[model samples]
Target: MKVSVVTLLQESNVENFNSGLEVLKKQTLGFDNMELIVIDQAESKSEEQIIELAQLAKKANVRVQHDNSLKVEELRGKYISFFDFNYSTSPHLYKNLCQEMDKHSVDFVSANLITSIREDRNLAGAEEVIGAGVHAMTGLKLINKESLLKMAGENKIELSDSFIELLNVNFYLRPFTFNYVNKQFYRNKFTFNESYVNNSISHIRYIAEHVDLSASKKSVSLMKVQLLKHLTFLLDKNMFTDNLSEEEQAAAYDVLRNFLGLVSKKEIQSNDLDGYTPLFNMVNKKLDEEATHYIKLLRSKRHWYEQTNKYKQYFEKNPYDLEESLSWKLTKPLRLFNKWSIEVKQWFYKVFLLTLAAIWKPLTFNRKIWLVGEREDQAEDNGYFFFKHCRENYPKEKVYYIISKDSPHLYKVKKLGNVIYHSSLKHQLYMLVADTYISAWTFDECSYPAPKEKFIKMFGKQLAKKFTICLQHGVIIHNISPYLHKDRYNQNLIISSSEYEKKIIQNTLGYSDQEVAVTGLARFDNLHELSVKKQILIMPTWRRHLFKINKSNFLKSDYYKA
Candidate 1:
């Protein structure tokens, strides 16, 4: 069978490619008849780089071609595989994979081995947390061509649904059915094994099994209220508690839930909006019909205080003009419409026109919008919506991210079509360029930006009415102060995972009830139990004030009580 291998090549440096090519030559174990397609992963269009690739393919005795031919859909076939050049493969990796392909009916296939790197060490599939870029699927695999054409044509490079679930939780590979060559083979995360010996493995595994690859069976994660409904059922009904590993399933969430109860035991005192992002996210999550009634009352009073005393006083004489400056201050309601004055009437006319333009925004999807990526490495894995869901959901709009220079995704981000990368954008530049926007509480877990600046920039005095959504990423444990501090601006949507969090976010961020939802991260499904006998760990994270597990025996007196 002919295998089509598509890999991005990385040379330590192109003009000096001898050493890297030497490594590839020695990789093949002297095999033949394989077709190799190389896409230069470098940004430079240097002559020497192209030459080096051609020469290396010749020495390996494999057919080589440069691919810039068509879009992803235009490229298709059975038995196709991809990876960057830095990936290493064992002598029989692909051959064994080929033999295994002969054994099962599948769509696409990847390596049994995934590694997390920190410095020189390989953290072999330890917990295999989903988002780190350090993974290199074994460079060898035989894929089913029909599946390749199917997924590629649809522009889905990875799973169809549950992409967020994949990111937020740890997964394990399926055994035998997965056919691993050795124990503890790792997948991607920039981890260094540090002191682990050759055979040591994390007690947990990721992705214990592969579900149906067909699109019909995909798209299975739930909204927040739905997940909570299910979770409440599971815990209240004692459904999985009978299983031997049931303790592990509850280890991540239980401790956090209890710890919050413990912390609440203390007095409610005011402090400068400290590390409260997670706390607010949790409270925001609890903002349902029941929770909203009480929370809205508190938010109303806070709003009155801010408006009567804070916001009106603060931005009254500011250089920039807006209906209201964003702050933990009073809000200006759109309902106070006095359109009779010629000036007010003109602004109303402009607002009327902008609303019409918004109705047809789809035609201008190519216009760029901000996809607020977390700048910290730890939070980078928080499941970027642009790459999976956002881009997929709004396929027409161009997405841009302003991330820190050290972000691992800089190169990969460029590869994603219509995505622009920026860093340290000036306030002026941000006002001029950004359209719709999304943001999180910072790595420092403080407040989100008051979005009106974006509105004023995009729509002038008439805020662009951009559809902004602020969803929390992890198990939240801090309080509802800084993020909800009377100094932040309210957003269009203050998304959370629980009703309690919804209340906190609305009270803190000052967005109203219409602004929030508890849609669970589409990624949280990892915590769920599949229909089959799959022994996997879908461990979501917890904030410091939430919970910490033993990492070994999850239930050993430290799981929930701690």
Candidate 2:
């Protein structure tokens, strides 16, 4: 019964391991067959975090290795049990794992599939796919490490890139014991890549942080660590499909609807938990008529199609052009601000239309140039909103929504009436023109470009009487002008829907006490009021120029010397 413990060190879950360590120590003191190995990979010996592990080792007489990982080749002859920071299983997780040998010869034990808590034989032993746990708190017991080493060779504990598909299917039926102890600890954790896709309203915060709804290619591509992480929980095969017996259609319906409830964007139309579902699972379940219907509904708006086509067109242009243009090279702030600007313009365009009253407005002058922005997602926008609003609210006034040159409805929009159009984000004179410059959430306004002449014209003397209204879109105040800057966007008419945001502006951005207004956000206000009384909030802050520092620390930064 000799047992060896292996753990991935550098995780911040000291509390999680605290309880498990206590349990392991108790088990070790009573049983002479255990040897615990806690790898401390902390960069420096900060006693605050890891020194206690050494003390635990001393108290339990277990070996604790610092700053080194076990070589899989060297671990060959040992019976090993590995856990990440998340080892909150019942002690029986280990005790029951040892019971697998009684069933038959076993190679390894996995922490994915679990027995039914209901204890019904009909449901018991049924395989439950636990994709989220893959590579996360991966706990495995090797009945024969020598056999694994021979099988894996130098492959070690690292999962091969190709094998990720298997894990993606929830540790596909590998030869391991399934412990029915899976639980989701991270709240509001999404199962889908919400941060990867933009203009997708699945989750507002992630959409604000990760995806851009306007770009065709958006930000939805896969990350290596993300792709690697969700796999290890996979079994050797997908045995759960077998449970659909007699209810294949029903099972698919459940899975897809279950999935639909997961991946949908954050619109007020349907289930708003789109960011939490797995797109691959939706595809797997899409074989049925109802599932297909849901997927089509999931892709629902033209936004999805437009974005898809845009990405298709981009890649189609040269086939391999992205190797040079990807934004991963920039830090988070730059990448996010770039996304925020594009979407704010598109948001200004799309949301304005739904609220406008009239249908057409004449273009009084060619001077009114409409410049389409860089929202490649191609999500549809409503030039009509601005036009109709202008005509109905203030008739005889010329108004136009600038659209990208590649906009599909360029001709149709032109044919609508006297509306004018432009194709690039570089359009000027509009922000500099007329008595007042009004925008819902145009990026060209909120973000200060004062240092550059192009951006400065926005705030130039000609635009002095200009009243630029910020229709706060995304939540999170990081992209707004820096706090140190004396002036922020035309501060006279600043408005926001979030009270928290109003507070944030006053506290962080240093808005003049009288100039700011807490007018509700328009795009989501109706949705918030009518749907579930949920109004999205958007206050902001920039990226940590150095490391992960607390907001409190940031607030205290002006006060702290260090």
* Most TM-score-accurate candidate: 2
Residue by residue across 166-208, what tens digits does model 2's lDDT show?
A: 2222222333433333331111111222111211112222222
Looking at model 2, which ten-residue stretch has the lowest summed lDDT?
231-240
**Candidate 2: C-alpha lDDT:** 0.41
The lDDT of each candidate is 0.41, 0.41
In angstroms, give how far residue 302 of model 1 lies from its true place: 34
Which stretches of candidate 1 lie above 4 Å from their native place? 10-24, 28-31, 44-50, 57-78, 114-141, 154-219, 222-562
Displacement of residue 42 (Cα, Å) in model 2 is: 2.8
Candidate 1 worst ten-residue window by lDDT: 195-204
Please provide TM-scores, in order, for all candidate models, with all chains considered together.
0.27, 0.31
lDDT (Cα, 0-100) at 315 in candidate 2: 81
Cα lDDT tens digits for candidate 1, 1-562: 2455555443223332443344344544333445456655455536775676667567444444445332334333335555334344455555556666667654433454443333334334322212122132221234566544543354534421122122222112211122223322323221122111100111111211222222221111111112222232232222222222423333423432432342322211222222333333444464222222333344556679888877677677555745445741243332333334645765764466566556545555536655555543222433454244555677665555445446677655545444433423232244334565565543112212234343344455433444555555653445555543425544566557788777766665566777777776544554474367768866554434435322223544443445
